[model samples]
Structure formats: structure tokens, C-alpha cells
Target: MASESLIKTSKYTKYTSYKKISYRSFFVGLLLFIVVSLLFIVVFNAYSGSSPRTDFHEPVNLDSTLLEVVNLKSDARLSSARVSNCTYWDCFNVYRCGRGGHDKITIYIYPLKDYRTESGTPFSQFSKEFYVILDTIRHSKYYTSNPEEACLLVPSIDTLNQHSFSKKHVSQALHSLKYWNDGENHLIFNMLPGSAPNYNSVIDLNTGKAIIAGAGFDTWSFRYGFDISIPVYSHTAEKIDSSQPDQKNYLIISTQLNIPKHYLEVLQNIASSSNDLLLLDKCKMDSDRIDYSKRCEYTTGRMFSYPDVLKEGMFCLVIRSARLTQAVLMDVLASQCIPIVIADSVVMPFNSHVDWNRISLFVPEDNVKNIVKIVHSVSKERRGELYWQLRWVYDKYFASIEKMTLTALEIINEKVFPLAARMYEDWNMPEHIYGPVNPLFLPVTAPKAPGFTAVILTYDRVDSLFTLVKKLVRTSQWHEARGATPAVHPMFTTFIMCDANRS
Candidate 1:
């Protein structure tokens, strides 16, 4: 009995010792798992943090002697472009701000001259604006020097305006440039700001000025521009009079002395009827000192600074001048004022991209009497919708100088550059280096003849054929009936023919 008892004690001790060992083994495995997990997390985080930094670093080639070659003679133009190469100290300077470096495009400024108008008005303002635009948006890169090394040459529209060079003369001059003589480099012509669209592409016999066709003119194949101007407004005055009760009413501020007679009559009629409508007309503007014509001398009315008037007005009147698009449009939009446009032919900048009808109300010039009626007819909900839409347009298109410059560059890249590339090579380049050649304005020819010739055959169906012939001939005059422009002059010509009559 004693031996059996001792054996049981020994078995119990061994079992207890085994249990203790099992517990320690479990704890050891758990510690190893925790340590491995912590190490993996630390390594993963380090790699992830370092990867983005390496990816974002701009590619730099430090070798000064290794020049980034921009071969203009090579017609290897890229259709999909994101990054532009700017040469710095003879090394390739790549900016990642544009689309990824695939399908790269190189842009350079023609450094020959600072743009100027014939009146000695310098385009330095635009140049400064453009440089800032390129920097902010990183859409283009500039070469320090040498037009020959650049594929695209951008000259300020104001410079062209100063030369009073028509598209033909400008084209000729571009052709005569030594760069063109090398059968390389193309000029992207910018039309003068605030000038009326000159659709008559041909040089005007009366005025030597190049008539930049109105914005959105189909015939304007080569001309491209962004006409955005910051408003000259007094913020202090606007804040001071913010509490005025009539501040939210309609205002028409014309700095020009002579508003169009039709537009003037319309304003007069609106003022005669509505006490809410304010007419601030002045014959002379401060711009007169700058030599820009404000208006012809005429009977004047009260004058108010632009911002003060713009602040008080909720609905502003925008009249179309020779300038295809006006600074007033940008001002009204930027101020968040609803625009009531009077010109039917007025084309908004980037019209092809955005819907203007969604943001502003357009009324025909002859229908000035309907101004108050239209304003009153708008529902409160609709007005709110228009206000938001106008605010959006302003923010996106003209909110800041940087944004405006970006807009111009976007237009060039999306609309102008591709078309220019296709048409650029087709231009009449001068034969000799610095050779004189007639400027070949684009589309290469006038619009195709408007009319088509049609032949009709009658086979013993005289009465029916005669009626059909009459209708076809009458269809030629449908444009005149609709009061359309003469651009649609003759629709078609008709010829009547007879086969042997079955009778």
C-alpha cells in the first residue's frame, strides 16, 4: 500500500510539471507573433512614406553642357501632351505640373521684342500676366533665348495690334522671319483685346487695321484669344454703401459718352418706367488719359466708379460694342451680378465650352422695352439658379488673374494648338532666308461658294415638275425671309430639263 501511494504522488508531480511547461511554451509563441507583427508594420510604413517622395521629385539633369535639343525641323508633333520642356543653362528643365511627362510639348516665347501697340502702349502687362500664368498652371515652359530652338512662338495680341498688321501682313512677317527660313517654328497669332471681331479676314480697303473677326466666327480659323479683364472697382466705396436700400436694384453704367442710339433709347425707356433702374452715363472715362476712346462728346449724366456702381447693382446691363466680348461681362459676373445682355451677336469667351444661356439673359437690341418685363417675369427660384450659375462661371473663368491666364492657356492647348499644328505647316513660308512673301492668312482660301447648282428632269409630268421647280427656286431665298446675314446669300441654282414627253 505504501509503494502504490508513492507511485501516485510521482505521477501527479510529473503531470503538474508538464502543465507548467505547456503554459510557458504558449506565452513564448505569442511573444514571437507580436514582435513579428510590429516589425512588419514598421517596415511597411517606412517604405510607403518614402515611395511618394521619390515619385514626386522632378527629374533634373545637372549636366550644363548637355543641351536639351528642340528640333523644329522635325515634324514629330505630339498629339497627347502633358509636360513641357524648358531649357535652363543648357539642361532640360521638366515640370511635372502638366500632365505626366508622356507626349511632351515644348513652348517658348519669341524673345525678340516686348509687345507694344502703335501708340507706344506696351504689352508688358500681358507678358507679366502670361509668365505668371505659366508658372502657376505649369501649362508651358519658356526657353531663355533663341526662337530657332522653339517649336511654337507666341507673340502678344497687343503686339500684333500695335503693328496694325492684318493676318496677311502678320503671316508674311512670320514667314519672313529667319526662323521660318529654316522651315521650322510657327507663330500663334493673338488678336487684340476688346477689338470687335473682324470676320472680313481680308484687309480692309478703308482701314489698315487687321480686323479680327468677332469671337466664335467660323471664318476665324487662325485667330485665338481670351478676353478677361479684372474690374476697376472701389472696394471701400462698395463696403460703405452696402447698406443702401436701392443697392440691389438694376444699374446701367456706361463710361462711353455715346452709347449706341438704339441701346440709349432702350435704357431711356427702362429708366422712364422703372424707379429701380439707375442710369449712370458719363461722356468721359478715366481711360481717356490712357488714350483709349471712352466715348464721343455728348450730354452726360451722373458718374460713379465702376466697383461702387457694380456693388449696388444686382442686375447689370451689358451692351455689345465692337469688342466681341466686353470687360463689363467679366465685371458683372465677377461681382455676382446677373447680366442682362443687349447684343444678339455678342459671343462669350470659351463659348464653345460653356453654355452662356444658362448663366445670363440675352435680349435683342430692338426689344429694349422688354427689359423690365423680362426681369419681372423671372421666378425667385430661377433668379437663384442664375445667380449660382453666374457665380460659378465667374469663379471658373475670371475669378483671379492666375485663373484667367490658365483659361487662355487651356484654350490654346485644347482649341488653338491642334488646329494650328495641322494648319501651321501649310502656311506660305518665304523662299529665302528673310525673304519677303505675301502673308497667307489661313483657311488658305475664302469660304467656299455658298450656292450649289441643281438639275431637274421632267418626263411627261409637266405640272408636277413645274411646281417642284418653283419650290426649289423659291427655297434659295429662304435666308432672306428669315432675315439671316448675307453669309447665307444664295442657297442653290436650279436648271430645268425635259425628256421626250410620254404623251
Candidate 2:
């Protein structure tokens, strides 16, 4: 009986010991859970504090009645009370009249073109007229000074130049204007020559600093300056409808031709031989040599819409003009027509957007005979490829005018305007006085010069030589501009060692 009681006691002791371990484990787990929860709470609070909060409140909208303020005198005081009382919604509130008391930067515009008038004027007149119109637009929007604010400074009709001002006059004006250096005023309008002499004078005065806007002006003069190349926007896509009559093969020749007589004669011969080419000369044709074959002639007097012309043709001839830039080439792309470029030039102005080989056939100007060969070689299958490629180009590059305009505006606002303002502020002031300045010119370190000369082997594409030379020149110039000696990198130089006679 004693032995049995001792065994029962041993079993009870083991059970009690197990119960104690279980209770201790439970308490340890509970403690860990509590610590983790506290850590998570702290992290969550820290994350919430670091995040930014957006303002979601609606702004008050301004009234159209405020537009009338444009006609008021420049010295007229805009009431701070009225502006402060005005409600704005989803708009930039002009706080000039408020407590800020900032000096407003004023931009003046003078538009010469009457937007209401349908009759087109000369390019010079158009520029001047547009300046006035731009000023009016800005003024109507109530651009004015409060204290230190950016505002539009449009002078009344009396303030505009009586006639188109000369370049000298413009330069003198630029030099004399203290307001331009004040960081609170600027001239943002276009200018036109009052007379031919004024235009010449400006050309002479501005020299390397001026840029021509359109084709009528010289582009080379602005090589060292800034130019605003306005692209012509078209809303047309070339559609190939099988239902339409295919009998009319429209040959559209839109080029500014001022080449040698021989060049014109060669083109005339080719057009005369082919009934498919339609020559649309924007200049007076050489009547004595023009081949009056079935080819239709459109003279220079009328304003020809690009879409209408492109729609009538399957193939468009893009001939190089001494005066015309890539403006027309862009138009052709917009119309989705196949451009057959006949130029002895490389480095197309619109290279960023165009794929030369895919959408267009680049023919060297020397190989005039190839024109017929290229035309005949383009089978229906090839045309299909060309069409789809052109469509892709349009979709990728010229798809959104509004987006492009907005992007341009953003650039002007964020980059150009700020830079101009700083320039004005720092005008006539030494760099040391203006705090630290960023390096405007940096040196370019070219790789080591190639031991052997690089040669490009070509059969008949002489026109491509110009492009290659231009690229080389640009690279060299870039290096020189940075005050660096460019050594041709032997490792990077490509050798076009080819046996062209084989294929």
C-alpha cells in the first residue's frame, strides 16, 4: 500500500510541473504581442506625419467684368479691397493689390494682324500686327502690377512705334530701357520693319543675335542667336479609299525652286516624260521650258491648302529650296503623304520627329535619273508599308497640338521667364555681386584622336556627304566652343569598309 501511494505522488508532481511551464509561455507570448503593437503604432504615426497634405478647397472664380480694367490708365490704382474680396475657384489669384506690395513685371505685346480679317497680309505686317493683338489679349486678362508682381505692360496706341522700327532702333530701345533691367518689366512683342531700310538696319545691328521667323528671312544670320520656328499645324490625314477613282495619279510638286537652269531643265524633262507627276510651282514657272504634258500646273498666286493637295496625290515630291526650311516637310507628314526628298543636304531641321528611311525615299540631287526608277519601283505592297509608317509618324509626333502648346507654355513659364527675369535683375551687375552663378560654358573633353583616318565608302549618295560633314562640323564646333581640343576616339570611330560593287 505504501509503494502504490509513492507512485501516485510522482505522477502528480510531473503534471504540476507541466502546468507551470504552460502558464509561463503564455505570459511571454502576450508580452511580445504588446511590444509589437506599440512599435507598429509608432511607425504608423511617423509615416503619417511625413506625408504631404493637399489643399482640396475650391477657389472662387473671377468675373468677366474685370476684363474692362485693360483699357484703364497704366497709373490707375487697382483697389486692394476689391481684389481681396473677389472669390476665385481653380484659378491663379492675382494678389498684387494685396499686402505683398511686390513690383510687378510688365510684358508688352503689339499685334499687327487683325484676327477678324480674312485677307492675309505680308509677313512683315503680320508680325507687327500680331504684337499688338498679343498685348491686348494679356491686358484683357488683367495682367498688372500690385507691388512686386509680374504684369503685362501694354502701352496705348500712342506708345507703339509709329512705323515699323529699324533693328538699330530696337537695339537702342533695348539698351536704353531701364525697366528691362528692373526685373519688373519686359518686352514680349514681335517687331516689323517700318520700311525696307529699317529692316536692313536691324539686320545689320542685330547681326548674329537676331533670328528670322519665316522663310522670307535669312536663317544663317541667326546661327549664333535664338529663333522661334513656328510650325504650321494641319488637321488632315491622307486616306486611301479603294472606292475612289484610281485613274488620277496626282503628282504634287511643292518646292521653292531657285536652282540653276540645268536643274530645272532636268526636272522638266523628267516630268514631261511621266504623265503621273503633278507640278505645283509656288513660283512663276520658266514658261519657255515647262513641259505642258498632261501634268496640271498650279501657279503661285493662290494659297493652296496642303491637305487638299496631298489628298489628290499618291506620291509627293519634296524638293529642297534655298529659302524654305522643314516647315513644308512637316505639313507633308501631317497629310500622311509619301515624301520623296530630292536634296543634297543632310541634318533635316525636324530630325527629332522624322524617320527618313521608313516614310521617305531620300534621293541624291545628282542622281536625277533615279527619280523615274524610284517612282516605278514603288509597288502597291511598298505603298502599303509607306502609308502605315507615315501614320505611325503622325501619331507619335504631331498627334496633339494642344499638348505641344501647353508644353511650350510650361517651358516658357518655368524656364524662359525665370531666366529672363534673372537676366534683367543681373543686368549691368558683376557676377560676384549676384551671388554664385552656374557655369554657362563647360569644357568638353574629347576622346583620344584616331591613329588612322576614318573613311565612309559610298557609291552614288553624294548628298549624304553633306550630312556626314555637318555632323563632324557640329562635333568639332561643340568641342571648340568648350575650349577643348577634340581627339578622335579610335575605339569609337566606325569604319564603313564595304564592297559596294557586290550588291
Choose the strongest candidate by lDDT: 1
Model 1 sits at a Cα RMSD from the real structure of 18.7
Candidate 2 lDDT: 0.41
TM-score of 2: 0.38
Steric clashes per prediction: 7, 32
After the best TM-score superposition of candidate 1, give how far the Cα of residue 184 lies from its true spot, in angstroms: 9.1
lDDT of 2 by residue, 306-424 (tens): 34556466667666544333345555666667788766543443232233565777787788656767777777877766755665555444444433322222222322234323332
1-503: candidate 1 lDDT, tens digit per residue: 99999999999999999999999999999999999999999899887865555455433222224332222222222122111221121212223112322332344443333323344443333344334433443333422233323434443222223224433333333333443332222323233332344432222211111212223222232222322112212122223321234446553333333357777776776676666567655445456553222222123344455544565566777776554344556666766677887766545555545556667778787877777777788777767666666665665655665565555444434432343331221221213322343456445454323356666776976567656755665665333455433322344577989799796
Model 1 TM-score (2 dp): 0.46
| Predictions in order: lDDT | 0.46, 0.41
Clashes of 2: 32
